[model samples]
Target: MPTVRIPGPPGLPLIGSMVDLARQPLQAMLAAQRDYGDVVRFAFGPPGLRGEIYAVFSPEGAHQVLAGQAANFRKESTLYEEVRSTVGNGLLTAQDADYQRQRRLIQPLFTRRRVDGYAGAVAVEAAALVERWSAVPGGVVEAVAEMSRFALRTVSRILFGADVEAAVDVVRGAFPVLGEYLLARSFSPLHAPRSWPTPANRRALAAQRELYRVCDGIIARRRAAGPGKAEGAGDLLGLLADARTEDGERLDATELRDQVLIFLLAGHETTATSLTFALHLLGRHPEVQRRARAEVGEVLGGRAPGVADVEQLSYLTMVLKESMRLYPAAGIFGRRAVEACEIGGHEIPAGADVMVSPWVTHRHPGHWPEPERFDPERFTPEREAARHRYAWYPFGGGPRACIGQYFSMLESVLALAALLQAFEFEAVDREVPIGQGLTLQAEGPVRVRLTPRSL
Candidate 1:
């Protein structure tokens, strides 16, 4: 194989491309791919703190790193370590045997059959949102905040069940704190250790403790209520608490807490982002919004949507897919190379930081013709089948793909369809800037003007 230095943009002495990256990570990554090829090398920081991220922006490269040569990469990035600090050994941050065992036990709980039971719960929340929006002083709402509320409420209800009302406020307040802390800690090349009493660390500690207390209290209540009390209930926590392996093993208390934290945070946050941007995009394109609404109207015919209806909301599903293609929640993720590997004919040194960006790859002109347009028809069956799978992986791809993929889809489709059926939206901000947190966040306001649908 020929050895060639990966081409990338150069920068000032100590910090290579850090300014541009910090300012606009998605745009920087895309520009890099446009200027260089699919594989690009970027170095930042200084000396001992220096970081070299090998950005893989092609479908083949993403496949190699995330699937084909998965064994050669480890989730030892700073980001995972930061998440582990709060989440313990949950599947999201666990490795090796622990991950395999967790996946085995938890996989059953997230299967289509099991998560389908969540549709009713999602519909309830969607209806609640519709009610809330109906009462707004004016027919306008901040799409980002409103979507976040809907998502957090839905996840809380599914996780906490009868006790949901109690947990919602606590979770909504505390998660943003923890998310901010996690983002800052993961990216900070130099900061006081978490154990130190810095204000940020102190605030993070308080938020972490508060969240754990809420989850712990709920778990205790469920345990005290016993099996008979929750027998017919299919809440996420109850399902996880009751999940038993073929050998009759179950997640212990600590493991239960870890998994619940992952679900509550990742679950709500990601779906909120998907819903927010889908709404934003739909509002931006009146024709697309009209078409999606027509599909929802035809499918539900004014009835509330449920799990059974999710699959039939085809055009709306495409709208969500295209939204995620443009604004994936987990826009960028990292893995550390454990063994030397070659991806896309470029040699990746062992211990190198490898970043795979769905935000960049999904916009590849090779896969998406007018990559920047809000085009939902791109997700039609024929077009989707013709494209490379990894090229549009909003939920990721491979063994480590998001376990909540279907659930997110179900929730997003149901909420979106319900909202679209109830109201027509016009974008107040045609272009919303994004800021990276634990999940992608829309910077500033994502405002949408709403008019109740005459139907």
Candidate 2:
């Protein structure tokens, strides 16, 4: 084992680096990577207190941690624990055999052929969103809120089908609260127990119950409709309810609820963040906006985008990719070293919290020439092909990669195309500040002005 002690700033004793991490995570991370090398260490607290986070900012280290030697790492970080507590033991936080089994059963559903089936549903939601924006009193809309609404409706419709409307009310505004609650818990060294009924805990738990209640009710309705009805319903809930393992085991009621809740959380809010930022970026760059809109017009020609359009809207896809690079939804993810391992030429012992940050790695000067500039050109085929595979993993990489990636891209492309076809954006808030949450979220409204597009 190469026992070269990783270099990093040892902050104030007892709560080493916690203040910096909790105050401005992104900035602190960037500074850490830029000042220290690719593999840097940051203590979370005093000695033997969860030790220190070994952050991998190099593509090589990212590949090692996330994919190459994945077996040596486990999703056992406090952050993941927080998420598992709030949501459930769904795909995001499942471990070992549970994760493998769930992945095997759920993987087939997200195949290109099956996921593309939801494109029309995505297009319908996109069209509705474009129309909704048209009705904004001043032709100005809050991009984050609007994208959330669109993504929520679209995911709900796909997940719940006929019961879509029943879920919207309960899920709306609940995730942010849950996200804050989770983040606070994830970072705090010591906190009151969740059962202690603190104000914040109460609000978060209430939000969780209502969200779960709505999903549970929908599942119950499907169950009442009978197995035949559920299997035949042709939606996510029905498919999950009907999914069986090789041993003929099906997800129990609680298991079914877990899947639905996770799907809603991951499927909707993340997509909304991607769309909001993509539009916000476009609003700030008219040249890129015109070019992207032109591509949309040339391809769609006033017709709604279909699944095939996803391939043809190449430029727009690049724009979204660039936005995600600048602000990834899953910016920083955590894993624990299961055993001693070497990454980026440093020795990592077992039980250390390992973190891979796409936000900082995506800006590595070695790969991206001008890291801060928003240039969709970087995603051009030739450039993308030449770069390291793990250099741009907005949706994550490896065995545990996001299953909804295909659907997310399809929805984003279709939504962007439709929105571009409907309106031309002018940035109202040119610079929208952001922070980390359940996903990369804006600190304030990402507002943009729209002028209806002429046929």
Q: What tens digits encode model 1's per-residue C-alpha lDDT throughout 1-455?
A: 67899888886687776666565677788889999989999877666786778899999999988888887878898889989997677988899999998999999888899889888889899998998898898788998889888999898888878878877888888888987787666655666988899999999899888888988887887777775376334678888888888998888888989998888888989999999988888888999988888898899998988888888888888889999999999988889999888888889888988989998998898888989887888889999999987998877677888999999999999999999999999989977888777788898899999899777
Each model's lDDT: 0.86, 0.86
- Residue-wise lDDT of candidate 2 within 1-455, one digit each (tens)? 33778998777877888877776677788999989989889887556754467888999889988889888878899899988888899988899888888887788789999999988788778878877777889888898888999999999888877778898878886888998888877766767899998999899989999888887887888888877576337888888878877888788888788888899999998899899999999999999999999999999888988998889999999999999999888878889998988887888888988889988999999989999899999999999999999999988888878899989988998999898998999989988787888788788889999999877
Model 2 pairs whose backbones collide: none
State the displacement of the C-alpha of residue 57, model 2, in Å, after optimal TM-score superposition. Answer: 0.6
RMSD values, in order shown: 1.6, 1.6
**Residue pairs in collision within model 1:** none
Error of 1 at 304 (Å): 1.3
Give one clash count per candidate, in the order shown: 0, 0
The candidate 1 region of ten consecutive residues with least summed lDDT is 225-234
